[model samples]
Target chain A: MAEAARPTFRPAHTGFTDTIATVVVWLIAIIVTGVFVWLLSDIIWHGIGQVSWRFLTEAPRNAGRAGGIGPIIVSTLLILAVCIAVAMPLGVGTAVLLAEFTSSDNLFGRLVRRSLDVLAGVPSIVFGLFGNAFFCVYLGMGFSILSGGLTLACMTLPILIRSTEEGFRAVPDEYRLGAAALGMSRTSSLIHLLLPAAAPGLLVGMVLGMGRSIAETAALIFTSGYVDRMPQSLHDSGRSLSIHIFDLSMNVAGGDANAYASALVLIVILLIVNSVASWTSDRWLHKRIIS
Target chain B: MSRSRSDIFLIWALRCCAAIAGAIVLLIGAFLVIESMPALQHVGITRFFTDASWHPSADASQGTFNLAPMLWGTLLAMSGSVLLATPLGIGSAVFCHYYAPSSIAKFYRRLIELLAGIPSVVYGFWGLVVLVPLIRQLQPPGPSLLAGIIILTIMILPTVALMADAALTNVPAQYLRGAAALGLSRWGTIRGVVFPAAKSGIITGVILQTGRAIGETMAILMVCGNVVQTPSRIFDPIRTLTANIALEMAYAGGDHRSALFVSGLILLALIVVLVSAAEVHSKGRIYG
Candidate 1:
């Protein structure tokens, strides 16, 4: 009778504790969601009014206090182009080596992965120092778009390679076996079959890398320079979108309006890119399932 | 058989790409060391640890290159953000995993990803425009260590929550079922079985976020008052190592520039240690 009473009494205590824990957890969830909503709305509320057609098409005047971010947009695109151009081939090739050519325990593959992991964690400001030292000073590139793009390439490669590797790894082993049975040369099979199948992964990696490179500021500050003029050539210095925002807000007094507008444009670009990535992956998944 | 030539070429090309990718890390390390050598030699390494303030001058002799205060600032901001984020992140993760409907959990995850995708500059801008002003009402000077902590906490919260969610999801379903079989309540089971099973993964995530928090630059630089001091109070302004490099590197030249690189080198060394520690902690774990 005593033991039964003890078990019955425990429910009252445990039940109360459970209810409190559940309430606390629900409260935390609501708070986290509320914070996100607040941040998004705050930016959108102030910035949406500032963004206009003219804002996207014209160059800034009075050190970004007036006019638009026309040249900054071009510079941002060119820098991104250079970054992707350099990173894609190297990233895809490395991913191929990791996923297809090498075994899981291969020493060289492990070394490469370890290095990439360390590289991914390296601070962007440090990358700025390295890029300034190597590309600008030692290589005599100065503070050009080329230098900044190359710096971004180094920063973006690890993310690209890792994701692409995962993409390749997700392909079924039977597909490879079938290619072998069909007497398809390894190069041909990888080029024709593997690449297409892993396209979603590659797309994801590219979008993520682009997003990171586009949003970069510290790495570009010392390497790409602070020039806000229309870039005449890849060799010339040009301020990127993020760098422009940093400068406008921090240095140029009364530059907040344009800063908010530019930030809105950047956020829009990121949202579009993210949506496209997910949409494409979703379509790919549907196609794969249907077939 | 003739196609074998192309295959061989493709193999070699990939090998070369992998080699280059691996070598870039070595190259970055080498360049940082070479660039920072002048400052390290001129100022002497011991002084960096012992000096009282950072006053980098064109003349190397006159400047005091002590990084201790900034180092302290970086660790303080990093630890504070991590401490605040850990509970909030894990609580959200737990909420999503056990309590929320699947649809709500999915939406929440997407929201977290969107939060993560926002650039650091924007966070800093937001912090400067909104958060700092709010804090200023409570305290006189707004752009202090507290502001940086709050901004950093928001910036890293998504990372922690997402990683923690993944870790929680990776917990074996059998563990929960076993607790249920033993008549344990849901929260009781989480406290006793689920958390213990997922401890290493959550720790690894936290450590990785620590690396990110320490290395973060633009956000902290924008809001933090950029004062070079060891902050005694949370409201006191502070400068981090990353911010130190970004702020001073533009006008810095000769040994001053080299000293900035020394700071960069220190940051890189710190990151390498954190990454290694995470790897060691997650070793042999499935979630790694």
Candidate 2:
């Protein structure tokens, strides 16, 4: 210790601690980043060449056979449709009731708002079980697209409701007062002026909600059983890209190669959807800021 | 027409539905109780929480339940991840907001956002492929809590960082400028002014990350080795409540199935505490 304090005996260590710290940070960051990239690369690098025209169009077959994400793609779109239809209305309606219609002091208003927040926090796995218990056993819908979609609705409603509420709340009060002074009815004013004014933010909410519903796998599992065939109706069982990825990762034997490709595709889709969400939101909000 | 009775009634009705969100939480509580009653009747509540064994006959003719080990595992895994992530997450957030060049900070922010967009399964597989083999080289030959914790730390980094960054950003810029004018060093100004202002926000982020770590399923399921024992060491594999529900529900029958619902109930209770904490903090105006 005395030798080190002499400064000459110190091991050429001006920033030795900093060098070690930087090395450690880079190691941690690189490994984390590399693992993320490897997960995608392992899949896409192997699967992309196979992701030809036929692969996209054809159905997935038994292990190692030819198949595409056809049914999975349709299921994704279908779930998105059903989820948006159910969740958006419930969420937007709740938001409307909160922001414009009801005073928060009322018991029901407080209840709705809090429950939505709680609902948002409920884990996906629990939602899956709830879906299974209520919808599968009680409703007799069976493991179908509709049931999964509806369950997803329950899952994403919080996001939609809150965002929509924010959108409505964001509408300037002055605009409404000015409309009223110009002799517009409240209903007409809300529909023609307020809703239109809040439209972009509301749309952003819907887009983000759809993205969430699309990415979900766990909740839909119990309610939407794995089916290889295309959905005949809302009652028919189906698989989604997310569930497909889950199924492959779990059910496959040694051939983890396929799972990698699927992971890449899923990551790509997620990026696309999220970017679209942000873009739409920025554009919408930008217009609002200017207006 | 002037506002009328039906219009008011309809508005009230909608408000009633709006409040249905709160009722939904109650309904979920009730639903779990109802769903688990048969199982609870079969096995006393104490047995469910105390007993260590979880073997149910394939036929489910025999009752089987125990959650203590899983609960221990859940707590252990969450604590591991939170302790590791909080410092690094908050530190990175501080460095980016206060130290890094604006472009570099923005880049890091974007990187964190993209990380958030990656699905849990991808994270799991990344662990399965990379972490599992890496762990095997160590003393352990299985998934283990360390792997799960490390993976979870990364998973929650974006979430904690974003929230904390927002909190720090919300600190009045004038505070930092005032501190600079007082001749304090840059680090001292941040330590003295910015941190105190953002402490509540950072705490809020830590709490939320805890919630995420506790509730997470898929990644933990894959990386936790799904062992049903209380952990003796960080490398010791263990099953968590979320993993317990996931692993059993697919094949669980009778009481076993209902017990999984009971697990859900417990998780719901945990989440309520989290939500209420956030609500309390929000009401207290704790730097939201």
Candidate 3:
């Protein structure tokens, strides 16, 4: 009876047009892949020659025409640290509040979500202008590491909040129900159960946020003056690796090789950071599914 | 009344933090409006937006603040890039969804992800080092509108491809099976049924790509030649709104600085409208 009721559909031979379409689409995909391989090989071939101990450790001279990027590397790390420090807590707190505390259907929740959407869509250059107006001038932080960090924090806040909120939403509702049955208070359950379960996703967001802070050049170009020396404190102006790459490629004549090398380093850093974030997220997801 | 004081305190603290996140968006809007007020007042909104010349300080008596050329350049570059990217992106999506084997599909997906991860500055570097010289052979000025458009097309392809792939995959298996049962060819099914079903999703991706193309700066800055003129040909040099602000903000002050802020404001307004439109379309249901 079941066999009779099931409509028998045989696999049909593909027509010529179908075959042509498939082949064309396949060629297109291969071309995109080929482009990627070409870009990577081109950069790595030209850039790998510039990386060395001396290159990484010594301060640049001759207006970045020669020497190393030690100060630039330090300043990049410093700026990232400050950006993450300011953004992480505020972002996570807001995500937690939105996910667990408030009803998403509520007007306030809707408004908050809309605002985040708007913020996330904003261009980085606008953030540069804002940093120049608000942080460097209005707040009197000047074009220092602090100003750049703060500027990045604002740029990254919306991203972190959205990602963390997604992370929270990924938590199964059963955990909350079980905690309720166990008479666990809302705060305690969030601290002890929901947070531990959501830790991996949150880490993914944090790492991604770090990547944004690291890759940022435009906002930093304004809020952080292009000073070549190693910054002794947050108040002093600094140059990040991305900014260094920009300056070398644009401002100076015949600084192409160094720019390529620094770009290789930047891409390498980004790859490592992205891979770790995805790997951690996948591992945690697997573990959650297993036990 | 029975709630613990600590619980109340904790809730309030989290709420305050959340409010601050929302408030930042409003604050940015307010700050841009206020900072740009000087330019808005000096040139008047009509002249600032309508004038084609961008002499911000030709003389104390009269400084031109026209935004026509920059706006024209921004739209020209964005439209040129997005139009070029859309078909290639959709084609790649079709390949991934239908043609590729599982291993090849996975490999291609990872390649696209890595492409998306590459920084805009790296794109700019490659453009300056490789693309510009290549273009120089064709056009005397290497950093032309064509270069910017090409760089942006490459940058946005991965984003468009990924989004489109997701949309294509989300087309129900039942639809494909039904078409197959009806004796429709694979290409016919994709074109007549699957494409229509995934239309909204693909539109969403294109809208998102448009936003990115408009907002892109560093790469365009490196290659757009920073000419404050309307581009008559693909190889003509032009200055986008983003490049204009980045180019002059360092030395600009008083009314000149305010003019830059006003440019930023216009950009912000444009982005908000695009993003909001994308959001609305994404939420809209097309099929019964």
| Fraction of native contacts, model 2 | 0.30
Ranked candidates (lDDT, high to low):
1, 3, 2
Model 2, runs deviating above 4 Å = A1-50, A63-66, A104-106, B4-6, B9-13, B57-61, B284-288
Regions of model 3 farther than 4 Å from truth: A1-13, A288-291, B58-60, B284-288
Give all candidates' CA lDDT scores: 0.88, 0.74, 0.85
* Chain B TM-score, candidates in order: 0.96, 0.92, 0.94
Which is the winner by TM-score between candidate 2 and candidate 3? 3
Query: Considering summed lDDT, which 10 consecutive residues are worst modelled in model 1 chain B?
Result: B279-288
Query: Residue by residue across B183-240, what tens digits does model 2's lDDT show?
Result: 6544555567778998888887787678888888888887889978888988888899
lDDT value, residue B215 of candidate 1: 93
What range of 10 consecutive residues in model 1 chain A has the weakest lDDT sum? Answer: A1-10
- DockQ of each two-chain model: 0.54, 0.33, 0.50
Ranking by DockQ: 1, 3, 2
TM-score to true structure, per model? 0.95, 0.90, 0.95
Worst 10 residues of 3 chain B by lDDT: B279-288
Per residue, candidate 3 scores C-alpha lDDT tens digits across B1-288 of 245566677788888888998988888898999999887777778987676578896231367888889999899999999998998899987766666765777678778877878889998889988889999998788899999999999999998988887788778778877887888776787798889999988998898789889989899999989999988988899999999988998888788888888889999999899878888998822111
